[model samples]
Target chain A: MNSTAQDEITAYVFAVRAALGDLPEAQRDELLEDLTEHLTEVMADGEGPLTDRVGSPEAYAAELRGTAPFVGGFPDPPTRPNPLIELRDQVLPVLRTADVKVGGVLGYERASDFGRLLRPAWWVLRGYLAAMVVAEILDGGDQPIGLLPRIGGSDGVALILLAAGILGSIWLGRRSFRLSTWPKAVLYGTSFVLVIVALTGFTQADGYTRDSYYSNVTSYDNPYSQVEDVFVYDAQGRLVTGARLLDQNGQPIHLGNAYCYDDEGTYADAPEGVYPYCASKAPFRMPDASDAPLPSPAPSGISPSAAEPSDAPATPSPSVSPSPSK
Target chain B: MDTTQLLKGVLDLAVLAALRDEDGYGYDILRRLRTAGLGDVGDASVYGTLRRLYNGGLLTTYVVPSDEGPHRKYYSLNPAGRAELQRSGKVWQGFASTMDDLLRERGTA
Candidate 1:
């Protein structure tokens, strides 16, 4: 064949090869070789243009595939790639990008046309949910909530839950369209619940910590007590102890005499002698009237009773009372 | 109604028959069929049928290297293929005769 005829045949062969895209590589190569041999022989006879005589390359490929035998023989020529499968192969990966996956949710194979149409809404919701997660993380404070607690706070649990929500939302968003009926439903349901809980956590987390701090301060019958005596409660409502009162630097602060008067003249938790006097002149007097008609311990002459000497400087130590006020 | 549809059913038989007299390459067989008035036969269909027959062990193939553009693969009938050809040929004849008689009777009626 002349070079012109050869180029024509090469181009035709290329098209045929492309059309046979779904065929196994070995089978396709063999088929192309056979067709090339046949085409060379046909063209040597000086036939007209191949396209004019052979029809389109795709139609030719279909006929070739229809009669082509498998390795063992022709056991019903391997089924062609269905149009829907072709569409899926083309569309799914493009839609699965992290940027586009939110919109791709409804575009997944099993998703209905109506669902595909709703992809814009899913896209918007995805943006909002992502923002909600970011907002939650930012507001969650510097200490991230991990699966385990470091600071003896519920912040970790809340943060972990929020993280789960973020992960679940992202996963569910990308694959929602591809998931089968019941599984998609379950995943969506789980995501919905997670997002709600996470959003609620993000909104209320600061208030939660503040309320818990106040409750903990009040949880102790006397906040001025020694570190070991400060009471706390577990989720089980059982009393827990050994908690220390730490300053901002986490160093334990001394609650001397464990009594001080507040700015409101209320009996406050303060160190002894720092408050200039006990919440009353008689220190170590228990607050409950029913427990005992207690005799004042100041005159009891307990040698280590430092509260007895400190009563004289009641007005001089105003600067020192500030430490116990906390 | 459609000869193309009928051709699909009988193309295997035609291919086996085409190889009976002497060995022929792919395009040679296509020319023989075209000369025998199968003008509508597709090049790919014939090539694919040759391959199917070769894979079925009904035909054997050998390459003939040429100074031309490409090597040619020639197909010949094996013993098993000859036997199949004879058997299927008999079946086709019987089916054709019966259909002819039925058509004649309907025409007369």
Candidate 2:
């Protein structure tokens, strides 16, 4: 027989067998064998189609059972439903109905399956944009970037923009917007690039560094506890002055020298006869004034005046004052 | 009346009777019964009756290989089947007489 005919016959026989599920194996097999033979004969006769002559396979099986009463009565067929089928039956109606309702509103009632599948893609993109908006807001001072204008400083504008993007994406996903081709390309491409840039900025943010916003805030420690030794030395290593020191931020105590807390700290320019009380808490001396001309002191460590002219006398400066003028 | 139901009751007898003179396969027996005026007889009914008779040790079966088509399983009445046909025939005669009497009375009424 041609395979198609054979398959048709097999399907018919299987349906008959399924209907006769309550029969004993031996009896069912015997009946099926006879039916097969009979069907073959009927097919050869060509009086009519098998189904036309015998009715449905179920009815035929039932008639077969009606003839053989000696075979024990058929039991009720068992009911075993597939779980995936159960889930699909329960879930598909709600999803399909939603699709239909939304599709109607969007005038996409006849949209292809490809368009329907695109909803999840839009949702994912919207989710990514939403995260970026949140991160931009949490970062506080960093400006939102992209083709869109800055919506102002706070995350509030970013938040509103994010909500708009999400809603717009959802509408587009549902085909309600049905944006033009170029517009969609521009919007998605811009958003994609913007999300990448925002991610990079978020990873590199270091706004919480020490000098930021907290630069001049004093420690809560007691002024007395904060005081330390404040001493000044001349280029020849002679002691210029001594007093109680203040903290680096100048909180606790203030010595006579205004140059102490200068931006250069220990490197401040010493007046002709006076020593510069360094802002740095570490003890240090001035740089050598004996050099061709005195150089401004560096921000850190003893000035070269103290280190270079160590072998010289304790003259404060030959041009400015006499030797015992300490 | 649904003679098909009535045929069901006598289908074994009819099928066995069809094979009495000469052994025939399932379709051949079906043709013989239809030719005998049991036109309402179901194909499955005749085929089932044949299988039942064979299983009841009343009929013997053999396969006749056909080069023209599929092999045919031919059913013939064994000695036991012949005895069954004789007994069943006598019983059917008595039942037919009773039914005839009842029908005649109904017709007159």
Q: Against the true structure, whose DockQ is highest?
A: 1
Candidate 2 shows a clash count of: 7
For model 1 the local lDDT of residue A308 reads: 37
What does candidate 2's lDDT look like per residue over A1-326, in tens digits?
A: 45555566677788999999988898899878867666777777765556887678888778878777652112214668889999999998888888777777767873445476776776656655655655545654455443232344544665666666667666655663578888878867876776786566555554445445575444443332233223444554444553333435644443233444544544454442233344343343345434423333533443435446554323232122211212
Q: Which residues of candidate 1, in runs, are more than 4 Å off?
A: A69-326, B67-69
Clash number by candidate, in order: 4, 7
Give lDDT per model, in order. Answer: 0.64, 0.65
Clashing pairs in 1: A256-A271, A256-A272, A259-A270, A260-A270
B1-109: candidate 2 lDDT, tens digit per residue = 8898688778877887898899999989989999999999887777777888888788998999987568999898999989888877777788889999998989952
